[model samples]
Target: MAHDVQLEAITYETKEEVPQELKEKKLSWQKLRRYDSLDLESRSIPGHHHGHHSKALTRSLIFRLAFQSIGVVYGDVGTSPLYVFASTFPNGIGNNDDILGVLSLIFYTITLITVIKYVLIVLKANDNGEGGTFALYSLLCRYAKVGFIPNQQAEDRDVSNYELELPSGRAWMASWLKSALEKSMFAKQILLFATMLGTSMLIGDGVLTPCISVLSAVGGIQVATTKVTQDMVVWISVVILILLFLIQRFGTDKVGYSFAPIICVWFALIGGIGLYNFIQYDPAVAKALNPKYIIDYFKRNKKGAWVSLGGVVLAITGTEALFADLGHFTVPSVQISMCFVTYPALILAYAGQASFLRMNNDLVKETFYKSIPKPIYWPTFVIAVLASIIASQAIISGTFSIIQQSLSLGCFPRVKVIHTSTKYEGQVYVPEANYLLMVACVAVTLGFRTTTNIGNAYGIAVVFVMTLTSCFLVLIMIMIWKTHIILVLVYILIIGSVELLYLSSVLYKFDQGGYLPVAFATVLMIVMYTWNSVFRRKYHYELEHKISPEKLKEVVGGISLHRIPGLAMFYSELVQGIPPIFKHYVANVPALHSVLVFVSIKSLPISKVPVSERFLFRHVEPKDLNVFRCVVRYGYTDVQNEQEPFEKLLIENLKVFIRDGFGLPQSVLSNGENGEEIMDVRQVEEDMQPAEIEREIEAVDKAWHAGIVHLIGETEVVAGKGSSIGKKILIDYAYTFLRRNLRESDDVLTIPHKRMLKVGMTYEL
Candidate 1:
């Protein structure tokens, strides 16, 4: 029966295993369809248009997004003015001339790092409109086979927007670089580890940003009057952090809408106040914008200036959030918001503080609040606190987005992800991550208890993330943009030197407080590495243990089992062959379902898969077996919780397949050898009687109604007898601990407890 099955039954053998006889055969149906067993590429990319510039966007919409982006993308960077000056001169200003030099560093750092590196360059490296370290890694994976996961197949490359656009010979350097990255296992591991380390550090930024931003804002109470003690401010900031994270379940859409106006008002007030101070105090202080001051100030201060860079880098702390949050906005909007609004406001804010310091150098610690006119001090203080909260909110949401992406890529443990907006696919809320971040933020605030200490930790996280972004962006420019090698070298010479300088300064302060993010990142990297390593091993085990059609028939024949009435949906991660767990289930169970469907839920690297192209169907061999394989592909941002609609669509596609006679070739149906004749599937459909098609559809409908049971494999991992101690510690201990503690596959899928059947098994990796 298996041998007699039609050519439409897609075989599950690798390319090397397929015989020349099978390769020569083709059907009329294969000619009509865009996809076939031999060719899997799509005619068009799904739900995404690729270009450096966004398509079909209006100027007004860009401006509107620009306005909204201020609340989300710029909040963290914008709030830097509240603490940068204070942190820079922690021991108070030495010479009035030092103010000019510090201001020069602030100006050049924001322009070089934020405006040029990010807004102009790194933003263009986005993968199908999604941005981040993972997006960059995904982009690299598309161009080259450097991804750590071994589960990717040829069909994965067929996903829309996943195709590689070959560069011309002009980019020979890039071509050489790509070849090197693909061939070197050691290099691939380093790239993967660095990307993970960057992501872990970003998560650390999420915890520290809120701690310092809120504390600095509330510290204005001490400046306003002596009534508010430092401890009181710490407790007050803790309360605000608790309240800020509590509202995260409302998601970015609501939070952005509510916070946008407050942030706008805050930016306006600071800009206005800065201009006033610049005019009233010392207009001559504008000379600080000269590059020479940066040189002279360093010469004058020596080691003190280098250490002050630990504080100077704070001016650009939120730069990562700008690129990380690009998925939520257009490049034009982020660029306009930064270049026109956020950039100017920060400059004037720092300038006004510098001008005031020129006259009253004694108030360096109190520069921001002291520079404000007494009449509006109280009102400005209120807005400062609100802006700080908004800044905290933005980074927290960005953290959730990154973790959700990691979970989809199998780099993190399973967690509950709630889609917060119906219109925007990127808006998501992770309940578990949110609470954990909140707790970490509170603990840090209580432990450090001052803005200066937290500022040390904050600068380390920020600079380290920036350094990693530069490294990733360099590769992207070479391999993706195919930029000239000379220009890439120049970029490294300039940006690389500045970031390394700051990196050294922060490392100098490791004992003061900089150890926090390092500790956080190390722990997170271990968790991620453990989960991803175990997942890849398990997938390989299934791939190696796959059962052939002959073996499957033997098992069924030996069971002598009754064909029960409903449909059994066996879920696994394997895309091609039947998993070993299915054989284990059949051997132990007394009965089998009449219709069996093997369902594989796969996550593609793209942002969203179109509904029309979501399901790929393949009939298993043996016409009487009634076994089918359905590979449901989803983009990383696509919602997968709609169970009823998913079931309806699956059943409907199966009915269509049956009605068309599985698109059978004429030779197979008529017992001719080697597909000597061909018949189109449309002709077969036309020949079928309406009643016969209806009866076939009715049988499937009845089976579906009889009750669908979801079969999920619950596998445990242990080291093989031949394995060493390291394998045992990694698999038996770390993997097992994470598997038992984290959310299970059934829970993440929202499978009902009554309908889910767990088949337990163990694997010796």
Candidate 2:
């Protein structure tokens, strides 16, 4: 529908300009209230508006993407085979009558949930080149454009000079920008915070998948090779764990090419093996495909059936990762990959495992190795092991991506994020994320003491994630697709009910120790959520609401404000006792140092500008001395890193701050000559409640020293704060990129010049 509408710049007569933000207050049902999926800024990548691209192939991107891709995004879900079969069979599908029941349940679960719900439905919801919660939340905030009140929202108290530049590429950019200037900053920020919580929870799941899969696989190996002690299997799992961690500092871009084809072959072998077995016992389990099997299994062995659902739920373990990693592959590409490669391979393997169970006619704790010949078994085992390794890679990659994304959206504390190569968008690395995963994975390998135990603990967190995702899906189908309430309700009820049944099984296993993971996830969620709240600082804009645009334009239009000859104006840097720089303006050279105004501009953290007017003229604080101080408050938020906008804002509201240099009340700017020192500003409030004048004075002092923004180590104020070294990791390495671009001499250290600036902050989280 928007394609037909040309992208013409809208012009309004000051009368009709209404100075209004273009937003829709449509009562379209319950007001969809723009979610992460619907935001305009997040709707496309940097080059994507006209074309497309990831911002840069930097080390941070490599670490982030790789970890997420391997850890949470793809790995966990891929390695679910360890217990998928064992737990699903024997009582659930082990017997003749029940074989069909278990098989049918597994078959349908994959087809509907993994294939349809994941590959088709959930993955399609990705916003632009990014996916996951924070990315989605950003998109929603950008597009919703609900509350806007001029400059009132952008004036944050901590760092009062940040302004976000909204790209004018989408259908509602202008409207959203206007609304953002007024209100709804908190709502959008809240969503971002929630999204971060989601990412952290997602990553915690990563440490468990490989531990469970490899552990389960190893258990089977031990069953066959009794000569090989369980310790040997444990050692093997540990070694693989070690290798996975070591390679993380680098990325799989070069090695990843080997990933696809190898994984493909692995799946093919699985599919072929499954097909062979299915045909042999095809008749025995044919009845399993029917709905009656589910009913029968539930009726005859209710408790067992419930227990088995835990294993059944394992089939779709990585469902959420499918959506989280949507940024890695385009919608069509991921869909194709899942349908043509991932899905078939998984389904056939499950079927093949079922056949093996039928033929064995017993509780085969060693399905993966025992179902086949010894010579074939070893090689097949190798293939499956290789597959498990690949699955691990995927989980690692996914975890990296989610955490990196969390940092980008300020959901986590700033960490050392490095993109792997300038050429590959997929290659990313995060020192903090990598080290943490490595530590957690190692802990996972050792803590549970066995993969079998890990398996019991693995499915719970994923179930929680899956349930939340399902809720989002229901919202999309109903809110965006506008499906009938009844239909949406029915779909949610059905999916949720079935999911709960499976979750119950896992929950039952909690005492068997599944609660360990759930507990871990809960803690992670808390950290992520808390940090976002505490460390979230908004960049403040020094808006000049006192000055009228009309008055400022008059001067640029040749009208005169005073007898002052030159434009020598000092903004509210509020230096104590007039620095030598300003003295230069008054002393020796002694030119007409007139037209000085210490303008104080207040800005809101998020855009919450009022839609009705451009600026509030009422509380317009005016000053009386030769230094006329006028203050304009803005509500715009989410903008970071830019030159101070004091001069520009002053021009916009000249009449409000300007005063005839006569006897009058003294006005003090937040950062003015008269401003006094107070306490250090840790971080700005996420809500942008204007900080006290005392904090502003301190900010000016820090600004005078030209302090570097601490991306890392300042986690006391950020969500999911990483190591102080996290920021150091990026800053230290960033110099390498810049050094590579500059002349390198043995006598000098090389790096991103930004890092060279001396500061008190610690490096390398």
Candidate 3:
């Protein structure tokens, strides 16, 4: 029956040479026209043309976005004023000189790190419009093949945004560096490790930010009323943290409107109060803006001031949020907010607190509240708490974004990612991550019981992440920006030196709560490393054991297998040929679906894949077999949960390919009647006069409706008999446990249970 069933291979005829009209058009125009011709109605092709809006940054949009960014982007950094002064003077200010010096340090730290490094320089390193550690790694990986995952395709590099001019002259050093990084496996592994370490620290930031921010804010209650005890403050802070995490499910969308206004009001109130206090108290505190005071501060206080640097670093603790949350707002908006609002307000606030401390040295323990006038204490305290919650919300959202990026890059385990906003693709909520963060925050709040110790932990996580970001930024400067070698070295030297100083200061307090983030980062690092290592090993094993498509085709041709009437979609990591699971399935079942598709989903290093360029399809050899190979590509930031829509779009595109023969090289039809003529896929399909092709299309549609079954390989990794006991324990115990407990194939694929079949196999790696 298989031999009797004959199928005609649909083919098209066209010129092999390029047309004169096509050659005459500019490259940019051609690209614009091509994107314009794509079907905008298809969700699969997220319009790449949306890039235009980013390019057209109007004045009104900048101010509006800058104001709006206050709520989300600057919340964490803005609330730092609540605790910086108190944390700095935990042992009480020694003299009037110490207050000025501390204020000076806070002023310069915020200016240098927050405004200069992050706002002016680091923001430029964002991957497309997306930001974060993984986004940086993604940008670097695009220039160099350092990513451990083997899923990237050639077309991934062909993305318009991915293209860059080759380095020349001194810039050749960058190309050489990229080549060196890619050539060494050890270098690749090290790069991967650094990225994971930074990401883990970011997760730690998520836990520590909330604990410190809210505890510090609520501690103001104790300052306002001496009746409040330390335990009461801890309990109250924990309650607020619980409520914050509880409301994560409703997402930031519902409450996002109020964030901007609340934050705007908070900043305005703080800035206004800082000015009022600066004038009313020691106006001479303005002398603290001098860099000489920072040196004088260390010279006078010695080790005490050195230890105080840990607390002083608190002023810039949320600096990373400026860059991490860059995706939510434009760089211009962030820069504007920082330079005009956040930067100036922070400087004045710290100076005003120092002025207040000069006269009332005993109130150093509660500087923020003590500095406030009696007439507005209650309202100011209320605004401070609200601002702290917003700050915590920003970091929590940031944590979700980072985890989502890690999942896409294969560095993190699969977890359910809930899209929190339809308008913003990057806004997401992970249930597992949310609960874990909440628990960790509560634990930290209860354990530390004070802002001073939590500030130590917070400083460690912040400085380490900043240090790692600087290291990564060095590579990005060389490879992506192609900066002059001297400039790159100087950039690293300056940023590295500053961050290392803060890191050392923070690390000095390891016994005094600094170990919290270290422990948190270590645990997260191990999990990420184990997951990525197992994933790489499994993929390599599959590659080594994979059967060639030609061999599978010959074997199928020789056997009298039953041809079933339905579409079978085989999901595999292998992109090129038949997977071993397919061979195993055919050997056992002795049958094949009427239409077979080997599908591979790939995550590219870019921030997003355009909808028109998302799917790449080709017919497997011996077209009569009715076999097709499809690769669905996504950028790390792209949404990947549309399984049903993805399937439907693939089928629709495949039908167009079948009728119009567009995927085949020689089959591209060009209408030469006019230079302005546009070739539409639907029009080409309609122009095709093959009756048999139409019949096949209808039959395939019928088969699709009959049922589309998803076949996935369920592979178990175990050590071979020849392997060491350590390997056995690692694979059979740790890896297997993770696989069993983590999300399964159906969850990742979003495949319905009734239409899915898992074929089990074992691999000894």
- lDDT per residue for candidate 3 within 1-765, as digits (tens), equals 000000111111211323344435554223323221111111112233322124788999999989878888888888888888878878887777988888888888887888878988999888777788887887777667777543223344445566444445656777789789888989988888888899899999999999988998998888878899999999999999999999999877665546999988888888888888899999999998788988898999988888888988888877888888887789999889888888878777887888888899998888889888899999999999999999999899889888877876676777777777876557778888999999989988888898888898888999988998898988888777778888877876877788888888889999998898899989888777676777777776766677766786785665578888899898886654556777778878887788888887767667777776777676665656777777676777766564327778889877876765433322334455654334444443454447857865886797798789999877878888898887777788877777788777667666778989888888878
Better of 2 and 3 by lDDT: 3
Across residues 1-765, which tens digit of lDDT does each residue of candidate 1 receive?
000001011334634222333334455334334333322322332233433333689999999989988888878888888888889999998888898999999999999998989998889888777788878877776677676542235555555566656556667877789899989989988988888898899999999999999999999999989999999999999999999999889877888656778888889988999999999888887887789999999999999999999999999988988888888888898999989999998888888888888899888777788889999999999999999999998898888888877775677877887778876657778888999999999999999998899999998999998898899889888887888779999999999999999999999999999999999999999998888887788877877897776887776556587789898888887765788988889879957777788887766656566676677766665535667787777766666654327777878877767665552433333322554333334455555557765776776787898989889987887999989888899999998898888788887777778988999888888
- Superposed Cα deviation of residue 471, candidate 1 (Å): 1.3
Q: Could you arrange the candidates by TM-score from highest to lowest?
A: 1, 3, 2
The clash number for model 3 is 2
Off by over 4 Å in 3: 1-54, 150-153, 166-169, 555-560, 642-644, 662-689, 692-696
Task: State, as a TM-score between 0 and 1, how close model 3 is to the true structure.
Answer: 0.89
lDDT at 274, model 1: 91
lDDT of candidate 1?
A: 0.79
Off by over 4 Å in 1: 1-12, 16-31, 34-54, 150-153, 164-167, 556-559, 642-644, 656-696
RMSD of each: 5.0, 15.4, 7.0
Error of 2 at 567 (Å): 21
Error of 1 at 511 (Å): 1.3
How many residue pairs clash per model? 0, 119, 2
Question: For each candidate, what is the lDDT?
Answer: 0.79, 0.49, 0.76
Model 2 Cα lDDT, one tens digit per residue, 553-624: 333233223333222333221111111222322323333223334322223322222321222211112311
